[model samples]
Target: MSSITSFNDSLMSHQNFVLIGIPGMQEKNSWVAFPLFVLYALTLLGNITILYAIKIDPSLHEPMYFFLCMLACSDLGLCISTMPTMLGVYWFDSGEIPFNACISQMFFIHILQAIESGILVAMAFDRFIAIRGPLRYRSLLSNSVIAKIGIAILSRGLCVCFPFPFLIKRLPFCRSNVLSHSYCLHQDAMKLACADTRVNVLYGLIAVMCTVLLDALVILVSYILILKTVLSIASRKECLKALNTCVAHISAILIFYVPMIGITVVHRYGKHLPPIVHMLMANIFVTVPPLLNPIVYSVKTQQIRQRICSILHLKRTRG
Candidate 1:
């Protein structure tokens, strides 16, 4: 269409597009692009392998592995949804995203983010039942129960994240189109809107509070109960074993949530920090979690480790 052509023309006119206007940060050269491209490839391959390993291994057909599979799937979705566009912007210096494409990316990014939060909460609840009421965990967390919860998590994520992009669509973008962050994050993207974005901002805050903050609170509560139950077991060996199993999950949760909270806080209060600092924090928030999730879960879960070994052998045999 004419509009598309015009947009493309505008993008083509600029040979050097700078996101932050820093002296050296103008347009992503191959140096930055190559490293991120490699990281993205590894993240995709690692998470997808974990997903398939969970699916094919009979020994991992339990609730924990089921949730782990779901987590891996969400991580894949997260990486694919954000990384390509980010890398494109960095690599080609093509910061000119079509309006529709930007909106679409925003939708998927928010949805996947919400799903990750919900899945983490579900995983925490699974741990709570496993530690607090092992006898009932099987009955309470059956395949049917987990299936229903997964459906609900996906549905709720889509429902909550839908309004965010829709709200963004309503706002007219007359100001600069360049985004502060690598990808089109909702809040950062909204900053470029020439029209009033009070409603979008308010709605986004509500969604984050309900989906991210509320889920985090529930995860914390589940862990608190799990810790209490573990302590009451009285056997030092048993306690250590239980803690060891959970240590990886706890560490992953901390790594994922801490930086997220850091970004939120810095965006709100630490405006004095340099743009590069903000950019670095945002990159960390996206990259660190996915890369670490498979490492932690696979390293901690015995069944997954064995399954991975089996798969690697099967691949070798086939080759």
Candidate 2:
């Protein structure tokens, strides 16, 4: 009975420490929960709708749309894995997650993040084949090839994220458990470790550099090749159409990656910045891409916009 009581007391004390910074976490956070909630809800619904539409539409069964569906699905997973927990903590003051739950959140967040990175790389490759080798596009990126790429993406994501949770598990918690961010980010969580986290930090950084940064470099090369091919095309109309098709994808990639780089740089060097600034950058990195992806694709892709309108019309007719 004495040991149980002691354990309970220790748990309560840890909880108290974690809650201490909660009051200061987002004390001045603009109170935009309602808007953010609605936006996230729409993102979830919109992405799901896109995935379903592509799956069901016979005309949309090509490699490009197949990859778009995968992108939508990954974005949906990303938002679902991170946004709810973050919004709950930020808006409802329910930031007190158990240690295990926090670790789980960190794991899934990183998994989805890696998946997104891989999907972007796959999309860039898809565009490369379509533009540079148009005649062989269908034969090269067959259904089987796409399935193999999808499996590889999930596998790579799991492999990259495997070390993160394992490292977190080994860490001894001695300091305050209070996390400064709305969600349980790996680096932020590592700061609470009393153990030597040099290994964890090094492994995490290496995985990110290998996966995300390397993929970004490949994407840049693909775009450069694509630009050269486009410039060599004979007809101005074909060039404009090709460029316009790529514009939405380019915009989405920039919005997603630029803020991610900003967050990484700030986390590495701008530790002295105000907490609000850190929080704002984190929010931009997390929220903006999910919100902008569907919008950009819908505006750029006539098929997606048409399907959305058709779905809306069906709902209105039913109502």
Local distance difference test scores for all models: 0.80, 0.80
Model 2 regions more than 4 Å off:
1-30
CA-RMSD of model 2 = 3.2
lDDT of 1 by residue, 83-123 (tens): 88768767877556666677787798888888989988998
**Ten contiguous residues with the weakest lDDT in model 2:** 14-23
TM-scores of all predicted structures: 0.90, 0.91
Q: Which residue pairs clash within candidate 1?
A: none
TM-score of 1: 0.90
For model 2, the local distance difference test gives 0.80
Cα deviation of 106, candidate 1, in Å: 0.7
Q: How large is the C-alpha RMSD of every model relative to the true structure?
A: 4.3, 3.2
Clash numbers, per candidate: 0, 0
Instruction: State candidate 2's TM-score.
Output: 0.91
